[model samples]
Target: MPTKSGSQRKRTALLLLLALTGCALRVPVRQLRLPDKLPPEELGALRAIYLVLRLADAETASPDKLSRAVALAAEIRRALEGPSSRVVAYQITASDEPADYFIEQSSATGVLWLNLPATEPDPPPQEVDASTATASARPVEASLKAPYHFYAEPGHRLILKDSVSAAHKSTSTAENQRALARLLAANLAKDLAVHPMTLHRVVEEGGEPELKEAYQAAKEQRWPAAVTLWKKVSTALSDDWTPLYNLGVAQEKEGRFDLAQEYYAMALERENSKSRPRKSTLRRLRNILATLNRLAPSSLEPAKGGAAHIPAWLRQKMAVLPMSNETVDIEAPQVVRAKLHQALASRGYRVLPLQEVDEKLKEIGLTDGGQLKAYSTQEIAKALDAELLFYSRLMDFRVIPLGIYYERVVQAHFTLTAAASRTLHGTRSTAQGAADTGDVVLDWEEKVQYQSVSEPKKWAEALAWQILERQVSKILKVQLKEETEILVLKCVNKLPAYFNP
Candidate 1:
């Protein structure tokens, strides 16, 4: 028999012990699961097959329409012949070669005819029966007309046929035609073969900061950074499947489908049955694996030889310095610089991280592009610890929009220097009367002009109608980022590859 105070103390101790035990036995609820719905694969091969693309036109079609048809056919052919495509080979011809001839001669499995219309047909008038119509009755609206029609004949029978319109309306006819071609090509490719579907990204509830940061980096297309951050989180949370699945997606985007399959399998094994994401993940993994087996069974096997040796030129560290910007767009230099860095890295060059180089530059009070010319190339190379130095100048980046006419211009100058010899390696331009003292590595410029001459009045009417109906027109005049990327790639492709093998 204990006293009253002793009894109270004993009860409190028992309650504390029970609470501790309950906490110890508690399980953590994993709030991170795949999203309920996943997007369809945007690109992949359905089967290992080939097809022939034929361009056909209506008798009443204008020369412009015929040219557009040709462009559209070319774009579709390119898409069908993409890496993930089952189309091992494709023949594009305007000749009257029968589908059977292609099948026999070109090893084509099918023929696709891209028919161009004389003109886009107007929407049919809404039908309404006035006699039987009630007050709430609505007219049946007509569907929009498509400018392009695709007919796919595989074997003896017509297998697939569809009409596709341009992705969006543009002020420029050239742009509109390009957009239409791309949209139709993408649709045709998807219909013809199996393309990889877009996957849903998982978000952890009350997750660590690194997870969120990694997600943001991935969204921005910074693959290397996203991979690093996700890897860190994966190491810390071994049981969590979100990071593993993300890793699979990243690898897949990089064309490392083998590594992607392994990661996806690991994720599925760790996944609990509480969510439906596991089902989709498993299905995707199986589809990819099956496709791989059907196409390249040898790919699944280990390579006979080890990794190839990197050349000495590629092994030497290179640095792309901050570009000198002569344009008003302050962010243009950085955008182009990052693109250049990615291009170099993809080409097997050992390029220093832009952030690290920027830090090194900052240490010496060289931040702006204008300040770069003040420092010697050798001095900058020494500061960056780089063997090779690449410099750039953004001479022109402008977009001028006047009514329905538009002009886009992008010009860049690049120079490469060997730090050890302090010598420039390129042709010296003599176009400006006085030749450049130093050899010019690259001086590239591109300009695009679009004028809507045929339907100026129609465009004006459309503009007025849009203003009255929607308060804004859907015309996009400029795409600076896309134009910049194109410029950078074209410039970098001209860079001499120093690899011997």
Candidate 2:
């Protein structure tokens, strides 16, 4: 008979194989849905509204003034009817089909109010028969008119809360009134829109032909083709979240969980906070997170959804990437990286050596100096066995000419990302320093001070050559180094607050 330990080992191997097979067979399906419950401010995009232009008859105003105001109101009505407006339809006439919401504004003062018309008004009570009336019958309450015009008819609810500013500083009264009329009309059109919760479906419907093709490929489970199209879409709509979300879905379906999770996290970052996440998005996020937590607990540990302070352990194995160079010279990034490395290493931080980092990257099949843009910081950190990643970009570098002195200025942006949770913390630093130009004229006075020699001109010439031959280069380097050091220090000082919590 086999020993107990041998039997246990065999059973464990079998279970592992079964789990791997299950993961391989699983097909993820995500459903995208729009939210139904929306805040009032965002509900304006889904309703039909119209404007009521009430010109306050002022006896002091001339007939021409009234005509001009009417013309301006017509102009505003046209402006409000553009294709971009969410309003179903708008008109200056009250004879149109009853609008769900009405925006009434005074052409004189530019005051505005939104009104909801009563579907049915209570009919006035018929005069009671004197013989049937009891002595204690409720005395008829005399109706008194409201102090200010209610704007809407009886029983209609009017909200007189919105006050708009349409003031113009024109010398001519007519011009000012025209400008106010335009401004008031635009404001009223925007205010009467609905304020209800809403949801949207993430449909891969229309765009470029290539995008549609990509969507079709994804539906057929052809992942690589889908990924290509989605990536193109992402580049085209760099500021939009749709492509990023779609890419995440594709990666998840293909079993590239790590990449999928990163893409989803990025999609969330790109998403607008005002818009609620689709049901499909929320479901997919939860599925990915749960799967990652089960398969690789370490990778899921840093999903803090916020900028949590950097932990002490993460600071042990840190990597600083080459800063992005925005200037003409390509060597600036490397130079700055080397200086920043020295600065960090000197501060007792065990900064990863550039050679060792490159070797690790090669092991992961990334050759050359592939910075964060080429690959994600999380991917690079995992390859280098780094818990913390430092990224810096040189935003500006310029030398301002000042006659005898050149002012060197450097501005840099820095970000620290935690590899485990994908939290980002960033800061910007700037430094300015001056270097003296080695122009011959700059030292003309010093040369004149010692002018008593047989070969005074020759001596002066020799002296100037000795002092100024490489003086400009030397001065620039010193000044630049000083500026770089100051910038680095500022970044370092800010790190504690950003990472510490």
Candidate 3:
């Protein structure tokens, strides 16, 4: 009996040893892994949402948090484009507008509502003396209704959010018009992603809730399915960041590091600083960004010429002026001007030193560029002695419903012009008129029981600015050459590295 017991004990010890060895074989990851390039498939999906963000007067935002929000959006856009997604319009300024096709989004303290109970019509007033010509009115009686509230839960809604409409005007640019055209195509893409119009397509016909299935798939690490579902969510609902954020989290979990980062950047961009991710999440994000920076080519620099790949001929005879964006939204004008300046600088223009530029323009008797609709670029060019003209203006605006989760929207229109007539070149096209940048808009709203009651309009505008920055980055410098050179310099300098592989 003693020998048998000893044998059993030995076998138990051997089993414990095997278990320990198995445990030792598993590795612990101190940091999250991130990929260098945006996954092509994921880019394709993001490009499906043709989001047109409008520009705004950013002056009020200087003391406020708006400036950072705009920058964040721009960074996110750049990040998306790194993976090659054109979902966000190229560039942004304060005076841009949204295209007609893309739906707008906004939120309300978004409460419940009920009409007041009917009351008996007020009794006819007693006739006054002829001289008085006035009458005393009788009051009507009716039971007061209870305070009606829009009983909403604490979740986000993809569709069925509130959206308010605004009017549009005639003045717009070719770039603005192009942005409009692009938006329509993108909106269609969103619809296709949602209902899919086909059996094999990933988007479910029902709506936002349908994505719950995809969310589940992502949690299970099924990327392809999750990608499709997230696309549907993005397209079906215009500006709800909840799903996008979740999708990004799931994508990373599934080992789709590139795609995951894109989503997370966008999600974070959409969220206000107050709503930013926790430190742990940021740490994970930084780890991922560091990894991608290590992997990506470092040559991403601002473009030096027109939209075409060919660099513009450096004409000793110069011609350029500052651009102006005249948007109707109630944002401050100074912010718009500064953003435009930064955007131009990013495009690699040899701009006047900001202080000098301001003084020089003031000396020329042009206090506000937005006021002079026509000859805007010409006036600035002639005054600043900028032989090359850079002009921009704003136009139409509209607000509409977002079906994914019904939301209100705000929009703007704009154009950008770069002419070289000041040097009096024999060029016939005459670099005078502003080119259209297309419709710029921002949107947000809710239709879920689990969402907050914060007004979506502010959020909508916030999104518009965020996406606008990305648009600026894409529009200004589209040069696709290897970014290795600049990247190496940045890395060697011990500065922040570009998020690479």
Candidate 4:
């Protein structure tokens, strides 16, 4: 028989061993790793549609050039047919068949007309300095015209017309034209396809090994494996929201959107009051939900003639006028205006082409945006045959480079006005109504700044950094185009979805 003291000592030793084992087996905290670049997704309405390619000026185009265009169309078809999107099974026919014919016969949902000119436009006359009479004097570079035009109509409703040009430095016109054709086809395919969304990793320092392994699996694109690991981690750390958020991301990548949304909501519930991860998580959830709603099967149905079928906002014709430039950058206004036009069109707005608007303004002797203050909103809208007028101003556009620092600034203001507002009682002046009357429906402004700083220890490093900065600036137009796009989207989102007459 054991003594009472010895029995008590044995029990204490067993308890101590168990405590040590628990501590050793505990999972440590780990942080998530993010990718360098995030890929963009295409949420446009052109997805999963059969496309028909036809030449508008086929009678005038050369046989060789027409054949090349047909080949390019075939290439575009192959590119657009992918796992994510079977958007375009295209047919290239020289027949003058109408869009209705293809739609009825071949189940085509869209028609793209290639308006290729018979021959390249005559290059501008080269200029030579009269003072330099020597034959060695170089003539000024001549400007080249766009090689092709693409006009697209989905469901017989004209939506997009884009001119294709090549900026290739090659002196061969044929090579440039070929490049232009390929680029046009590529752009069309991109517009119609859904690209993979880039995954965003939420990193926390000193996280569990299972959590790290799950993130690594996601980075490798093994989404199923990642989900499994994330599930284990979430089960173990029920209080932690990070694993739940990651599981949502994995589910989204696997196209299980409903599951992803649920996970996101649950993660939000578990998230602490801290704003950072919560804000980011909320944004992701909203974007996914928006995408889901937009891609719904009901939204894909063609609108009928009935008022119930089409939204009131879609019936309104909007005219986006040339933006007023208050900045020193001469090209800023046009760039921003173009981006705004595309954004509105993508959102299903019936916006007039900028060219048509400009032509109408030209008829009224209004060549500049500053001159718009002279005319009433109704008069300008009537001229453009629009029910609404969108006025924009580029307040600031600049890219400044310091020793080792690069800075970009973009700022813009937008205003939407109802064209049917009654004229003021007192004033015979058309400009007075524009300034005084409360016709402005939506008004907002956005400004953004992007800066990058680097410290170089050696001459080689400094040289490389300078070169990289210059390249980035040149490629993205001073890195301000994206800022301009973001501002434009913000403005567009504020516009009323249902317009009341």
Cα-based lDDT for every prediction = 0.53, 0.45, 0.35, 0.57
- Specify the highest-TM-score model's number: 4
Better of 2 and 4 by lDDT: 4
The TM-score values for the models, in the order shown, are: 0.34, 0.27, 0.23, 0.36
What does the lDDT read for residue 38 in candidate 4?
14
- Pull out the clashing pairs in model 4: 29-206, 29-207, 29-208, 30-206, 30-207, 30-208, 31-204, 32-203
For residues 1-501, could you state the per-residue lDDT of candidate 1 as single tens digits? Answer: 856698889999999988856433121211111111111221212222333334343222334554455465556656555333334233333334333422332232344444443344232234456797733322222222233222232443444456544454544445555766787677656555433444332332217788778877765667689889888888898767778777876775565667867877776676644454567656765654454333222222121111242223465688888888889877667878898899889866789999999999999999877787667666777788987667777888765544344445667777665455322222223211111222222333433222333267566664454344322211342346666766665555434332111
TM-score of 2: 0.27
lDDT of 2 by residue, 1-501 (tens): 856698899999999988856433234443221211222333223222233332233222233543453454464444434322222212222122222111211111111222212111222244556797743322222211111111222223343443433444443444555665576555544443211222222334346777778777766768688788888888887666667777766665555657867887777666544266566655655655554433312211111112232324334587776566666545555767788787777755668997787688777676534334557555676678886566666765554433233345666666555455321123222111101111110000000011122254465565554445336645565435655666665444323211111
Error of 1 at 161 (Å): 51
**Count of clashes in candidate 3:** 93
Candidate 3 yields a Cα-based lDDT of 0.35
Candidate 1 matches the true fold with a TM-score of 0.34
Error of 3 at 412 (Å): 19
Candidate 2 ranges with C-alpha deviation above 4 Å: 1-315, 362-371, 402-405, 422-479, 497-501
Instruction: Output the lDDT of residue 187, model 2.
Output: 50
Ranking by lDDT: 4, 1, 2, 3
